[model samples]
Every structure is written in C-alpha cells, then in structure tokens.
Target: MVDDVADVAELGVLTASAAEWSVAVRRAEVIGRLAQEPRVRIAEADEAATQLGISRRQVYELLKRWRAGSQVASDLLPRRSTGGRGRGRLPEEVEALLLEVIRSRYLTRQRRTVSAVYEEVVRQCRTRGLAVPSRGTLERRIGRLDPVASVTARQGADAARALRSAGGEPPVVEGLLEQVQIDHTVVDLEIVDERYRRPIGRPYVTVAIDVASHCVVGLVVILEPPSALSVGLCLAHMATDKRPWLERLGVEAAWPMSGKPREIFTDNAPEFTSEALQRGCDQDGIKQSYRPPGQPHFGGIIERLIGTMMEMVHELPGTTFSNPAERGGYDSQASAVLTLAELNKWLALAVAVYHGQVHGTLKQTPAGRWEQGVAEGGRPATVSSETAFLVDFLPAERRTLTRTGFTLDHVQYYCDALKPWIARRRQLEKIVLRRDPRDISRVWALDPDGDSYLPVPYRTMSRPPISLWEQRAAVARLRELGRDQVNETALFAMVEQMRQITEDAAARTRRARREVERRSATPVTRRTPQDPAPLPPAAAQDPAEGEPVRPFEVIEQW
Candidate 1:
C-alpha cells in the first residue's frame, strides 16, 4: 500500500509536467498552512477553498491527503492514484531504478536518445523481472527534468550560466535550501591559540550561502586546513538548529535559517569531490553540482560573499590585510589577540548584523527575504538528528574488526555493540569506520547489515580526547625524540608533556596587549549592499551587553 504520510522532502517532483507542478506548488502553499492548525475552522476552510479554486469539501480532502503523503511540498503533488481509478504509480523499486538510470545515462554528456535509454531500461527490467515503462513515459520524464540541471549535465555549466536568472538572486532559485553554494578560503588574519595566547597562524573558513535569499547560512573556522571533514562539519551546522549553537557562543541574535539543501553547488576542489563527500551527499539525498572548469564566474555568488567578508576581517586586531601591500609590514603575529572561539563569536555577531542590513538588489534585509519565503512556501524541514546527519559526511576509514575491536592509527576502539559482530569477524570483510577529525575519542562503525551505525569508543575510556592534528603532532614529536616504535602510552605521554609546556608558558604572560585593547575599543559598522545604514551604538547591539566590542565592516557595494 502507498504511504499516505510519506514526508519525502526530496528534489523536484520530476514525474509531473512543469504546468502541473506549478499548480501543485500553489496548492502546497495554501494547503500547508491549514495542515498546521490543530483544528480547521469554518471561515478558514471556506477562504482556503476559495483561494485554491476548490470546494470546501475538497479543501478538507486535500489537507487529509497532505497529512498522509510526503508531508513536505511533495504531499500536494499532482497524482493519478488519488481516487484509485487511473493507472496507479509504478512499484517503488521499479520507479527508483528508472530514475537512477535516466539520471546516470540519459542526463549525461553522452546525451543518449530517449528511445535508446528506454531500451536500456527495458533490458534492465527484464533482468530484474520488473515491468518496463513505455517510451512515451520516458520522454515525458526527461521533459520534466529541471532545465538548469539538464543543460548543466548534457552540455556544461558554462552553457547553463547563460540561462541563469539575474536580479542579484541565485539563478533560478525560488525557495529556501533549493540550492546552497559552499566554498573555502584561508582567512586573511593571524589568530592566537587559547593556551598560550600566542599567534598560531591564519585559519581556514568554509562558508555556505543560500542562493535564494543571499543569506549566510553556514560557517566554520578552524586552525586546520580545509578538508572533506571541514565541509562535512559545515554541512552538519547548516542543517541542524542554530539556536543552541548561538546560545553557547553567547550571541543574542536571531539566525533562524536551518535546513538540508536539495541541491548544493560548489567548485571542483578535491574536498568537494572526495568519495566521502559524494557518498555522504548521496546518502543524505543532496544533489551536487560543480562549476565547469575554468569558469570562475559560475561560483560568483559564494566567492563574492566571501570577498565581502574579508573586508570585515580587515578591521580586526591581527588582520593580515589581504596582501603584503595591504599589510604594509604591520606585525600581525605580535598584535594577534582573539583565539579561534573568540573569533567565531565575533563572526556570529557580524553575520547577525549583516542579516539585518538591507540588501541593495532586493531592497530588504536577508532575514526579511528569508521570512518572506517562509510566508509563501512554509518553513523548510530541519534534520532530526545532528549525530546521524554528521556521521554520513565524516571522513571514512576501513578496518578489519578483530575479536577485540577495530584499530586505526595505533588507537583501539571497542563497545558492547561489537559483541554480536565478534563471532562473525572471520567471515566479515573490512567494515567501514567513520571518525570526526575534530575529536578522535570515538568512531562510528557501519553495521554489517549496512542500515545503521554503531558508536565505538576507546577501549580504555580513561584516555583524554584529542584532535587528529594534535595526535599527529604528538607522533611527530616522539619520532623527533628518536623513539622509532611508539606505543599508545608513549604517544599520549608526549601529548601531555606538550600540553604542560604550553600551559607553563601561558602562565608567564597574563596582561593584555595594549594595541589589541585600543583597536578593539571602537566598533565598526557593517554596511548594506544597497543603502548604507548608520551605525547603531555597539553597546546597544552587543550580545555581551557591555564589553569591549570587536569591529565588523564590509563595503556591501562590492
């Protein structure tokens, strides 16, 4: 039986025609509101029916169908099976296989003819003993594919660039989380470490910007270089609730944006193309698009936003100022003050300020544009489990599970969850393990059944949690000491010694730098893209209430 409450917040409904899908979206907008109310009222039902061009009874029927079907936009999709009189939908397995083949074979540079693709589908169905869809059906399916996606796949992104919509909005973006552009850059600022309060180096920042509203939806800053794990962490932040995150940062601001993107566009960097990222997006139902090689303009939205952000960084205490010419021999290392956490807090406040300022093209704030979108299409769905979503994107490692447990980088992991697999270890092949590069205290193991992941912690729970970079640094330190074969104990001992040395050094310098305090005393205002708004007193908007304020600036006209 077909599920009435399917809630499939997937990509576009490709099976329906564009005109039909348009009508469905309009209905979703109207019906989505009534579905949320605890009880439908007489006046409300009549108004909704009038807006939808349907009878009051039909409005009730539509609401019931939406509640039972894919609870998102797909719930209101046009279908032939509503009355159970027309040709019902294909079997789930058959439908999935057909879509998969069409996407992989037909929608490619090869540009196979519909007839050829249909024949291939027919052969696959015969092998699998499933019914073959007709050639007419295949052609219509191809016709219903998003034009931007079709051109990008069959021709190239450069060809698709000509088809993009203008007006400062993301090309062809009509809804939130429809397409997000994520990119990474080395921030042009030297940052200090939390331990010794000394300059560590410049850090990398990965940012995700929503195309529809030009909102900065996700951000990540770390001393480590950008990698697949950095992209994963940024994604995890993008989809989950940000309230708790903001509260922890002690930033009192409204950043209500959070949802999984239906399609994400990024540059063709190794981190963006890694198997871990590709498989993770596939697992989470995210479609990936890359800008064509040599076409820098394809990534203009994200790149431009990042460049604007760097202008704000220019006002900071330890700013490198973009280049040696801009720096003019200023000692960024000696003047560095803000640690990674403090810098992140400053960024949060800055983004909040940016969101409130009006966008020149849209003539409204980014947050206002976002709320306007919600008023029409409804709020996007947020991820239910942060851990589950993040596990899909974490860097993967394959290890053979012994009777005891799995080992990686000389560290062992075991849990009661592995007891069942221990007996079958000999028959089992190498199992996939995923560990967060940020924290290496535990790893998530893909179960033999391949459906769920099991959390495995260190065999000896007493070991302290450390980052992957710290672990490598410790190992390098031991090697420098002429210890050829290092054990787990020796590796941890070196790490502890290193931590003690940094702590003792930190004890020597307890006073704040005079230059850091002076520059940080005055707060700079973030200007809007269209019209520059006057700076509000920083103390009034400060999340810390009354404290030294970090400056924020961006010539939004850029």
Candidate 2:
C-alpha cells in the first residue's frame, strides 16, 4: 500500500507540472463550495465546476452546502461576473488617459521614477474627482499597462535604424603613427601676462595625440589660433623634450619617415587650411584629414582632455586683471601685476601635475606612454630641428628689386653669408626674397637656378622733421639771394597750417578738461536742503528800504 501511494503521488506531481490549473484545483474547490447556492438545482454547481475544470467531488460538496441553505445563488456565479454585465479592472477610458499622460510626460523625459509617476497619477485623479490609488496599486497597474515600455522600445528601434544607416561599425583606429588627431580648445581660466599683470587674452589649448597609444605627444597653450607659427613652436618643443626617447628607439627625427600619415585629423578651422600650414605639412610630408562637420566625437580623445583642463582651471582661484586698461576698467596696477604673477605660477603647477599624473585611458602618464612607445620600436616621425628651422623660419614674399638694391617698403637688406650666391644671382636681374617674420632686419634672396638662398641685411632710418625756426631761416636766405627757390607764399601757407594744427590741438585739450570738470561736478543724487538761503537780490537789498542797492566805496585816511 505504501509503494502504491508513493507511485500515485509521483504521478500526480508529473500530471500537474505542465497543466495550468491542476495544482490550483483544491483552492478553486474551496472557493466554489463557499460560493454555492441553494434552491436553484444543485446540478448548476457541478456544471460550473466542470466548466472551470475543478474536481467533481469539490462540485458535489458545493451543491450539498447549497441544498442545506447555507449559501446564495449570486455567490455561485463566476468570480469576475458583474451580475450579467462585463467590466474591466480599470475603466477603459481611465486607462487610455493614463497611457496618454505617461507617453507624453514620462516616456519623453526618459527619467520617470515610480514615485514621480505616482505623484502625476494622484494629480490626474484629483482633477477628475477620483480616489487616489496606493503607490503599489498604481505601480502594478503601470506594469499591466506598460505604455512607457512600448515608447522606450520604439525609441531604441529608431536609434538602431540610425546606427544601421551609419554602417554600424565599431571605430577601429589603425597602426601607430598612421593617424594623428589635433584640436584646439579654450582653457577655462582668465590668464594674464606676467610682465603687465593684465588680461592677455583667452588662451587656446592645442593638443596632438597618437591615436594608437592614446598619448598626448604635443600640447601647447597659446594666445591665438593654432597657426603654422604655433605649430612650428610646438614641434620644436617636442623635438627638444622627446629627443632622448626617440634616440633610445633608434628613430630618425624626420617625421613620416616610412611614409606620409594615412590621415591627419583636425577640425575645419581656417588655421588648419591656411597656406602656411599647408606648406609646412607638405614640407614635412604629412597628409591632412578633416573630421566630418559637426562631429566632435570623431576626435573625442582631445575633447575629453579639454574638459579635464577646464575642470582644473575652474578649481584654481579666480583671476583678476591688474591692468584696468586691458579690460577697460579702473583698477590698481599693483593688483594687476600680482594677479599676472599668480596666474603664471598656477598655470605652471597645473601643467606639471597633468604631465606627471597617470591618464585613465592610457593607464600611464602621457609623457610615460610617449616614452614607452618610442622605446618599443616606434620611430619619432618628426623633422630634424635644423632642417625644420631652415624650412619654416624663413617667410617668403613676392617682391621686385629697386635700382638701389632695395625692396618695396624701403627695406635695404644684405647678408655677408650670401655674397657668393648673390654674385651668381646678380646676372638673373631679379630673385624671390624670403624674410624672417620674427626679425625684419634681415632678408634672404633665393637663387632658383643655383639652388641656393642668399641672406641680406636690412638698413632702416627715419628722416628728421624740419623745425619752424629752420623753415623761417631758409625762407629769409632765399629772399636775400633774390631767388624764387623758396616760395614765400607757400612758406606762409605752411606756417598757417602749423598754426591751425596747434589751435586744433589746444581746443581738444580744453574740451577734454571741460569734460573732466563736468563729470566731477555732476551730482550722483540731489541732496536734501538742511538750511534755506536768502535769494541774491533779497540779500543785496537794504533792510530799511527792502530794495537792491550798489555798495558805497570808501577810501582809507592815514
């Protein structure tokens, strides 16, 4: 018997596993028996239980109770029957309104919390004069409604479609030195010059990063756009600072040694496309590449660095301009000087901290990553300092020579180093002159035929201004000589012009003084009268006659 019972129990468990309501038969039977009715035939109980798939024994018990008059007919109906009408758990109209509100307000924001949604539900219920549901109840209803979920699913689908249209490929950067990304960001601090203690201008930060190692190879903060001049300066600094690493790696100083870069990524700013920048890159054998319009993420590494710089700058003390004139204000020069000194000190400290600290992405300091890459067989793809200086230091210009061996702008230049080249070029009549933008005191003449450049020194002098007494003396001398060399009428006209200029200058000075006086005298606000004063005419009148009279003159007798 025990063995048979075990077998039956196992069979029952197996039968109930895949069937929906076999396990709930006992609970259903209890509910049905409690809800059974009398007088209406007991057959109704068995029929209802059979339709619900409950056991016949449970149905018979319910019918027995109904026959005993212990239950009601209404109780024998289906659990959810509305007497004869069908109704939803929540009204269809209310459900639709809830869905609309959730879709419009909560789903669009993408930040709908359960509490926030509950508050909104309560507000809606109050407006409609309905009882506010409990938070749990509202939450359960929302789960059943699931409108927000549908909206989110739609949004995700749209995003996936966009990704598919964009080719849906993960960004894969190529080999080391294959691509270099450069960009400029404004540093967040107000920087002032050390010498003047005045706001110099907003500092522009330019960064060059190796796409493979994610290392900052070059960084510069200049007070202007990333011009070719700025680029050259940064390159020169890198050559000096990064030389030991490059030497250790046995790499040549000239950049793009193996081949030109696959791409040189930068923004579509004017400086990136300037003639000077183009020529410089051409000389260095680098090909330029630009990011797609409005796509900063394409060059996100540098953009993140810019954010870091801004955070650091913001943490520092607020900067003040010492030179009021720099920002068009009135302030102490001493304060401006102090501010400038502090700015430089803080900037240096910040840069040092940044260079020493380890970067999260590179897992090493920027300088360290750069060195490691160099030591690990990566070549320093940069031009030699001497060669770079020779190519970029000279500024070329198109000019014609004058009879006096001078160029336009009255610049007379000659360099002893170029004597041999100039001697050979003298036969060519004219040559292109390249001057140094930094120092206009010297210029270089290029001999295309000889494949040589000649340096020339420039001599500049200013003629002195003629004095008034000197002009008069010259006129008298001309008259004594009985010569029409100096025209007296013209000389007087010149004197008259000078007089007019002096008069205009004096008038300007007086006007400026008057303006200062007016500003000083104008009251900021009217003062209340403390004591009244007699009118001028009233004070001057005699007391006896109450009329104005002139004062009598008296002479002192000794």
Candidate 3:
C-alpha cells in the first residue's frame, strides 16, 4: 500500500507527504462530528478535536480561516497591496507636457528618434529658462507618459465599428481564381540611370493580387499617377500571360478578364470611376464593387500587397535616393522607374513561386486548384473580346466645338464621315468634337459605322507672339511683295497734301485764338509804320533813257 501510495504520489494523484491526507481527513471528521452535536456543541467539539489529534481552539481557528477564504473567493474580491504608495516618478502635468511635445515636435515632424526628442526638450528648456533634464531622465519621463497611446486603440475600435457597419461578412476564398482584388499603390523608390550614372525618377506601382493564391497577376510601374493607362496595361498583361491558367480553369477569358472574378473590388479612386473603366466593365459584363472611402480593410488583400512592397523597398540596399554611387544619385523619377523594374522582376519570380507552392488558405496550389475547377466543369462566361478592346481603348474627354470643323488640341480635323450627317441635319455648327488626351492622334468624330469616333491627327497652331517659323517666313514674303508693288510717289504726294492742310488749319486756329485774346485784353497803339515794297524798273523806260543819253552824247561829238 505504501508503494501504491508512492506510485500515486509520482502520478500526482496524491502529494509527497502521507501525513497531509491524514490531517485533511481528521479535519473533515472533526467538522462532521461538530455539526452532529446540537446541544453542548462546545464539549462535543472539544471531544472531536482531541480525537482528531488537533486542539479545539485550533480547529475553531482553522474553520474560521477556511470560511473566510471561501467567502472571499465567492465574492471575487481583490486584496489591496500592502503599501499605499502613489504612482512612481513623473508628475501628471510633466507627463502631459511630454506627450504634447512628442505629438507636436516629434510625431508631426515624423522625427521618431528619442535622441532627437531629447535634444528638442533641452532646446525648449534652454529657451524657457527651465532646468534641463538628462537624456536618461527624459527617456524615463517619456516612458511614463502615455503619448496618445489611446489614439491607436481608439482607431482600432473605430475600424471594428466600420467593418461591422459595412454589412455582410468577408467572403471566404476557397480556392485560387475564387476571388481577386485589383488596386494601385504608390511605391517610393529611386530608379537609377544607366547612362547618366544617377537616379532619374520615382514611379507608382499598380498591382493586381489574387486573394486566395496570394499571386501578383499583373503589375505596372509608371512615372505618371495611377491612370487608366496603367490599370489597362496591368489588365492586358493578366489577360495575355494568365490566359492559359484562366482557360485551363474554365475561367472566362472574355471581357472582364480574370474570369469575371466572383467579385471585383477596388478603392474609390477617380481612375476606377472613370468612364473608360466603367465602359470596359460594361463590355466585359463584370460587376465592380468599391470599398468605403478611407476603409482599406475592405480591400485588405491589395493593401497588404502594398505593405509587402513597402517592406521590400525598405530592405533594399539604399532606403533613400541620396546614395549616388549605390542607387546612381537618382531623382524621384529615376528611382521610380528602377524600383518598378526591380519590383516587376521580383513580382514575376514571387508569383511563379507563389502559384507553384501550395496555399495555406486554399489547401492547394493556384495551378492545382485551377485545374480542379476546370475538371469540375465550371462554366466560362462568354464576353466579346472586340467589345472589351473597344471599351478599354476608348478615352474619356470633354466635348468642344470650333469654327473650322472641330478642333482638338488646337488641331482642326474635318471628318468626311460626319460631314454628311451634319449637313443632313444642318447641325454643322452644333457638332462638337471630343478628343482623347492620351491619344491626340484620334479625334472623337462620328464615323461611317455610326460610331462617334474618327481618327484625326494632332497639330498645333501658332499664336501671335510665338508664331511658327514658317508663318514668320510667309509674313516676311507678303511684306516684301507689297513693298515691291506699292507706288512710293503716290504715297509721298498724299503725305505732302496732308501736311499742307494740317499747317493751314493750325495757322487759322492760331489767328482765331489771337483775335479772341486781343478782344478780351486792352489794345496797344502801333509805334511804327510798316516799310513799303520796292517797285520793279520797266526795261523799256530804262533802255529809252540810256539810248537818249547815248544819242545826245553822239550828236554833240558829231
């Protein structure tokens, strides 16, 4: 029995001490005997305690302790600490000031370094003429401060509330191709230049992720903001490369490419709401769903993909574009392009690996699940590829009317196709042309096929100050021709006549003003008479006088 008890003790059924069981049993017996005694309970209790090898006073004390513990347990009471010590270290006011500094000086400026904050605190102290604390003391103070910790907690609570209000539980993607989320994320990376030996640009990375597969189907990196072009390129890539996977899975390779994803989800970005995108979906018969604004969790799959890209960027050799030798002194544009190229290369490899590997969520690889779906006879939805192409190609633009037919981007294009219709309805003046900003080569005109689009080449007209060289040359030629043909003599004669008439009018006006002034003022008497003009001598009288003098002299000499 001792060996059995030892075995029981080893198994934890009984404790190591054999006396413990005896003590417990004796205590229980004493309590039982005491309960049975109605009158003279004190004497009975004393007899029971003596029989149990415990004192009557000791038994009463043990019962009282046990009852107190039981009451405490039943009440779920908390015991106070031994000391009445207040909170340690920093005062509430100081802690609050620390948190304010953290928010205003640190968080707002994105300066998360503790050392930086320490220096700032010292600077502020010096400016305020307060005693500056040591770095360690400041750190301790910071630790004591909550520092808007509740803000994050409150945000999480609000997100939970928003998720609840969004309605409907999140869909459980069972297999690959079951669901896919498409979205664009801006990636900040320095793209290095091969020729310039410097980083040139930063570009945005638009990605489409398969939720169940965790595969990046398509990715496009462009310098411009996320536009319809970027989105279309991504979709086009998915349609081309993943066609086999889509076909084998009996997924619709039609309009809404990606096999009419059970549901298409994206954020409420303007590009997603563009007419081109909407028309493309209409052509593909794909129903698009938009997530609530500022609620990224609804499209968490793609948002997480963005986070993964950011992580990858962080792990790169240079986190910033400042490294001239390493990342080639790249500007935002160069950085963007290089990052996109690297991202694409990495994405391709990652996607291949992801699709080949068995997914934890789906319990099968994407390729495997796709094959299974195909074998299970999933119907591929029919969509017109032509219609899809048309919708994707169509560009959104505003309509405008111009004098010379229709002007698009300052280029006038007269559509022969639209001419007849305009003439028949006499709506030539009302006919407005809308051109795609992306493809200025094509003007939006009514074509013969009754489609309101006609291809017109893009051209620019010269303005007044900045006329084209050809226009300037033509103007110079016209001026030269006019100069050669014009009569200079007639022009001079006309100018002379005009000058004489102007002088005459000015003299008359001066005389009239003088007369008015003389009549208004006191008149002054003339001091001297004007000299008379000398008379011209008559030739006949002068010759006669000279001849008479000569004849009289000749007669006296004879």
Candidate 4:
C-alpha cells in the first residue's frame, strides 16, 4: 500500500505532516462512503481492511471514531500502542541524571560516543546507590535528541552552521569592472627559453577576473616569479584595450574587455602590498581591497578560472598534470615544445575560447554576461590612457640628474632633453625615474617643471636591450668571476659570454644523456694506504711552558 504520509510529503504540502493514524482515518472515510449504511458489515470491513493493510477490528474501530465527529483525520485514527516489556520503567531520577550527563559531559564537551556516556553514567550510578539503564536504552535516549542541537553542543558554531543550507551574504557585484579579483598562479607547463629554445621551467601567469561577468580582463605570463613588477604589469594589461594584443598573438577574435576596475580584490600577497601598485590605484581612483588572512576561499572565483585555463594548458605538450598521480611519469621538461613567446600566443587564443565558452555558474558565456552587464548601464571605468597607465604602474626610483644623466644600478641613461638640468645646481630635489622591470633599455623621467615624463634611453645605441633580471644575473656572474667594478660595457659583454656558454653546455648535456655509454667494470681494491709514519714523537711534542711556541719565533725577530 502507498504511504499517504510520504505521498503528501512528496507533493510538498507545507502544513502538518500526514501521520500513520491520519492515513488510516482516510482509509476509513473511503470505507464508510462505500458501505452507504448505518453500520459497516463484517465482510465490508474485512474488504476495506484488506485494501488498507489493516485488521477488520481496526477498520471498525476507525469507523466508530470517524462517526464520533472529530474535525481532524488524525483524531479519528487509532492511537499507537505503548508500554512494552521494561518500557517506561526507568526511574525519573535515573532518567534525569543520564540526560544531564549526556548534555553537559558528552554533547557540550568534546564529542563522545553514546557508549562512553553510558559507561560514565553507569560509573556514576555505582558511586551512588542508583541502578543504571542498559546500553540499548541509553542509545534510544541519545537518538531522540535533535541532531543539529547535538552537533552544535559537541563541535563548534562554525562546524554546526556549515551543516545548514544557508550561509553568509553572497558577493554583491552587479556590473562589469565593479569588483575584480586578481591572483597569480604558475602555469602548469614547461616553456622553452626565448633564445635557446630549451625548457626553462614553468612561468607564472597573473590574471584579473571580473567578479560579476566572470570574464578575464587582463593576463600576464612572465618568465619571472610573482612579484610587485608582475602585479604592476598585470594591472597595466587590464587597463588597456586587448585588440592590439590579440593581433600581436595572431588571433582574430574581438576582445573588447578593458578599463580601470572600480575596485580590485586581491589576497594578502606581498606583491599586492607594494607601494607602486598602491600609488597607481590611488592615482587612477581604483579601490584596492585585500582578503582576510587564512581565508583563501573568498577569492574562489579567480582560483576556479585559473584551474579552467590550466585545463587548456594540460592539453598541450610539456604539461605538468594537475597532480603527480595524473602525470603518471610524463616528463614535462623533456617533452616541452612551446617557447615562452609561443605559450603567450597560445594563452591569448585559449582565453578567447574561455570568453566564448559557457560558464556553469553564470549559465552563459563570459562575453554574454559582459554584454548583459553593459546593457544594464554598467560600463568600463576610464583611465587617462594606456601609455599613462603603464607609466604609473612601472616601478619608480630616485636618481640625481647630472651632466652624465641618471645612473640606475650602474647602467647609464642619457637624453638631450635633460641637457638643461645637466651640470646645473638645481634646488635639492631628486628626479623620479620609472622603468619597466622587464626592460631596462629605457626609463621615463618625471620633468618637474612640465609635470610630464620624458623618455631617457641608453647613450650607447649599440648596446643590446638588457632586462633588470639579465643585469642582475650579469652582475652576479661578474662577481663570481672575480670582477668587482662593473661597467655597462663590461656588464653586457659578460652577459653575452655567459649566455652562450650556458646554452651550449645545456645542449651538450642533453645530447650526452641521450647517447648510451657502456663500459666494463673494473676489479675493486680494499687495501687502505698505510698510516703515515707516526709524526716524530720529539717533533710532535708541545713547546715547553712559557717558551716561544714556533720555530720561526724562536729563530729571529724581524
């Protein structure tokens, strides 16, 4: 027979539950209407009992209760049987004592099993002159307590609250560029070096995701690890239109997402706390917020997007699969086929795919969400200009303007525009020089009088473009080679010398490993060299107390 209680529940009736008694009363009503008489016949009652899966006596009893005229079906149904053997025999005091221990000692403290609580109760009963209930009886009592209440008492508020369906307020982002999340993750693929085309390990990819639309506004894949410079470049990327960038990558899609975000959400990474980033945001009127410490899930949107992007990366060669188990002995470095530049281009195309693909949470493509946000009066925040944004975001250093121009980390930069300030005793003011950490060939100098920046390039036009990383590496190489006084000419020369040798050595090593070399094993020798003739006993003796200690001192005073 179908359970009316469960059926009513499945129908989603929000009122009181349909108990077994109410279900029986419903069957009785059907029986009464079928009988169409003052009193129900035994065969009629038996038929109803068969249909309802009840006894004839129960059918007649339900009919009698129904005729008594109760408005509710449950009231007309038979009451449940009770008072079986040993039931309700627990003394009131014993019951009270057990409940108190369970509530105060077990539930309210560290979680304890019912058996443990029962044993404690039994022990307490032995201390006093009271009898203890059986373990089965105690288990029934424990089961009757509200599960949620018990969990709250035994565990913690956070744990108990997590069990519920509801939670804290959802993020309130309503438009594109309203709230943006930025994070850095190392791309799970080995990329070759730009020059040598040899695997140079993985690169870090910094991404900025729009919170409302789930669109990637900006991304930067850098050879260097995550740092303040990477963060600055990422923000610069976010503020610029991506059409030219896409074209550079040879992609045909239209990526119209760009602009200064009104607010950027980031974690408490040291790069996010950098002065240049903070100043740029302040100058551009962008609000910056850091996630609270230890709670990484607050930035789950960007993390998930990074994971999705990596899924594309995993499809390529040289991919370090998500985990060691998934990789299954794949050699990412050995199989590397994409150079950093190629990876950059591939990422640009892959991101376009992401923008067009449907998002599970938003139920639409990110581009579609962006369009909807635009239709609802959401627009991109404006910046002065792309070039200006880059200048603002670049790391700054203080240098004195002299006849030779500014010298940053021993690299000389000169421009004809600085001639007026050259060799002139100006007021005590230091010029602010901003340089891209990736490329140090040129720097932007703030012109105090005009309040604009002037580009200063290396005086020697023949010098190759040197990055900050390369410059530092060259300095370290020179130091290792016993050259302390470094000049720009010597620095570049050393960097070129080291680069060729390092690349050649790596290539040779790779080739050598591939060629199998076989050699015959030689017989081993166990004999140890005899101990050197014990140093002469007379010569080894210590100098006499208060006597000059060495032969040189004893020989003569210079």
TM-score of each: 0.60, 0.43, 0.43, 0.63
Q: Count of backbone clashes for each model? A: 7, 9, 20, 0
Instruction: Quantify all predictions' global Cα lDDT against the true fold.
Output: 0.75, 0.47, 0.47, 0.68
Candidate 3 is scored at a TM of: 0.43
Q: Each prediction's Cα RMSD?
A: 18.2, 31.4, 37.4, 24.8
The number of the candidate with the highest lDDT is 1
Residue-by-residue lDDT tens digits, candidate 4, 248-361:
667777677777788999999888988778876786678999876766667888988898888989999999988889999899988998876688788887888889989998
lDDT for model 2 comes to: 0.47
Which of 1 and 4 is ahead in TM-score? 4
Query: Over the stretch 1-558, how does candidate 1's per-residue lDDT look in tens digits?
Result: 223311121234544556667778888899997889989998999999999888999889889988876666666766554466333266766666667788878889998888888889999999999988887766765775778768889998777877765323435887998999999999988877565677767778999999889998899886557899889879878887788888887889889988888988998999999989998999878999998777777788898889989999999999999889979989998898888779889999989998999988679999999999989887776764555677788889999999779888878888776877898898999998888775677777887875567667778777886667667988999889899998888888887786666555554543222223212221222222322222221111222244433322321110
Stretches > 4 Å off in candidate 4:
1-167, 193-198, 378-385, 419-426, 449-451, 459-461, 509-558
Best prediction by TM-score = 4
| Candidate 3 per-residue lDDT over residues 1-558, each given as its tens digit | 333222222221112123344455556555644544444367776876778666787656655543544322111111225465532244333434454566566544344678888778777767766666677866654454322332333344453454343434676765544566788765546554332333434457788876655666566665556877566656544443354433533444221224334455788888887777776566445567888776767887787677766666755543553244655554343233343345445555555555677766568876565656545645223221311233243455544444335543233444344344545454433433333233233344433333334433322221111112222333444455575432323333433443345345433443332222222221121111111111111011121133321111101110
- Over 4 Å off, model 1: 1-171, 477-484, 501-558
- Best-to-worst order by lDDT is 1, 4, 2, 3
Residue 89 deviation, candidate 4, in Å? 20
